[model samples]
Target: MSAPAVGKRQDRSGPGTSRLLAVHLRIADVLLRLVQLHALWLGWTLRGGLVLGVFPATAAVAAIARRDALGRTAEGSWGELRRDFARHWRGQFRHANALGWILAAAGALILIEERVMRAAGDGAIGVFVAGVLWMLGAGVAALGVLVWPLAAHFDARPLAVIRGAVVLLLGRPLAALAPLGAAAALAAAYYLVPGLIPAFGVAGPLWLVTAVLLRGGALPAAPAAAPEPR
Candidate 1:
């Protein structure tokens, strides 16, 4: 009787341990996903125009937002980050809002261009141009949202934002493409099976990484300049 009971106890214990481990992993994964989602959304939401004039400040604020989302302290160099944001905040905010107008116009143009191009029978070239314009609109809108917290924290000037936008456009095309592709793919997938509404929850983080990388700052550190002869 004792041996039979002992074996039953061991068998039950194995499943219990497995269940505990599985639950812990699910919880951990949820937490990590939450963190990444927030960070990525912050990056995606940052508008190109707003982020343009205030990249450094926006980056700092986005970092803080990421920390908050993760339930972590803004530790280690946080003070410096705050100060850096403060240095250019007022101007950044002004320009950030101003850039909103540009985004709106771009969106309108993308719509009109696509419609006109398709109607005019411009062929593949027209479709390509329409797609490009649409992409630009996406880039602008996504950047704004991704960098919102940063804009709120470290507003900057218009020219500055333009400079940043140019760098992103000319230098890091793939970064910009990632969020757009993700958004398109997600939308397509959602349409294919409307039952998967839960998947949209992941959109935030996907956009964030894309937005940041597109803005041309997330690359590995550049080599230090060679020193001149003493």
Candidate 2:
């Protein structure tokens, strides 16, 4: 009787241990992927000479995240992932840069305006202008958060992609806001644990945005192209 009881206990523990190990392995796999993604982003961004590299690197990340979100990607080897990311980065170089520099200019302009406002001192007009600029900055941030994923998932020109993102933001504010909140939380986490920045910083937020957009069905089935800027 005692032997039988011991065997039953061992049987239960064996499956429990296996299950725990599986969960741990899954977590480790996810962490490894995030690390790979971060490394690729950093490498490619540097490869592009930083200024030219950031947008395409980011676009590549967004494309990969979107595919992963849609269940179109597999957990392949590291070499495979790198090749895939490089392909995306190269493919998106022209269009991504076009979109990216425009947004970067807008953000820079906002910063310049803020600095001028500060130098002007806190007058009534300055306060009002600052408030308006703040709102504009927030709008631009929201548009940016939505833009890359839209660009990645849809087959449209840069201007059309921007228009699509704007439409999605206005139409699905909650879906758009969800990723922004997640991004803020990730930023806070990176601040507390600086080491995470190298591993999960960019990929983490981009993955969250992709997942939210996919799960929420915020994207269109087939987006119609908008006219190019005249």
Candidate 3:
């Protein structure tokens, strides 16, 4: 009753069916949170918040995923969501920009290489560039699913977070594909019904990626608390 007194810690290991139910419940919560995040992203984006606000908003979504994974959040808690979003947005602003620049640069290189390959129209260098572009795209996908969660869950330098994500991907290539596969599916769904984004855009993909990372033990488990004074 009363939602377990809000912050009272409980055993995380539940029965198999309970765990399955919880997963489903979490997905429902994520869909709600996704609407909130998409609204924030849209509001900020409309104000020319592209470079300045995108990462912070994205970080907020990642923060929600992290908090929910740790069992520190409750459903229908808008105040908590706002607080978490603001905290993550401020803490991650600079790092988000750093990541944005890196991704932007990679995208530019891919476009430039594509143009060169088009102009060359079949050559060894063209083929090589195409391969490089493919690899870069793959790397970007890995970075997207890993980096924000890394930032949300750890207190590390931005570059360190990037390196850790890369290391994790290299060490567990198959597991790493979870996020990329989720991304591709989400992208396809969005392409098919562009309206789906307004309804369940980032949250769907974020939850999918976060679920994968949690399963892989990429995030540290929340520590159990000491017993309250009796």
> What's the TM-score of each model vs. the native?
0.42, 0.85, 0.76
User: lDDT per prediction?
Assistant: 0.50, 0.82, 0.70
Off by over 4 Å in 2: 1-21, 220-230
Writing each residue's lDDT as its tens digit, candidate 1 over 1-230 gives 89999999999999999999999996675455444433433443453343443343343344443344334433345345444334433334445446555555666877787788888886788878878877876666665543343333223444454545556545766755564456667667767987544543443443344344434344322213311111
Report the Cα RMSD per candidate. 9.9, 4.1, 9.3
| Model 2 CA lDDT for position 67 | 73
Which number leads on TM-score? 2
By lDDT, is 1 or 2 better? 2
- Top candidate by lDDT: 2
lDDT of each residue in 1-230, candidate 2, tens digit only: 99999999999999999999999997786677778888999999999999999999889888888777776676678898998888888888999899988887888899889889989999999999999999888888877887888888877888888887777778878877887787788889999999888778688888778778877777653346421211
Supply the global lDDT for candidate 2: 0.82
RMSD of candidate 1 to true structure, Å: 9.9
Candidate 3 lDDT, tens digit per residue, 3-91? 77543434343466698999999677667677877776565444436768777667667777776666666556666666656666776
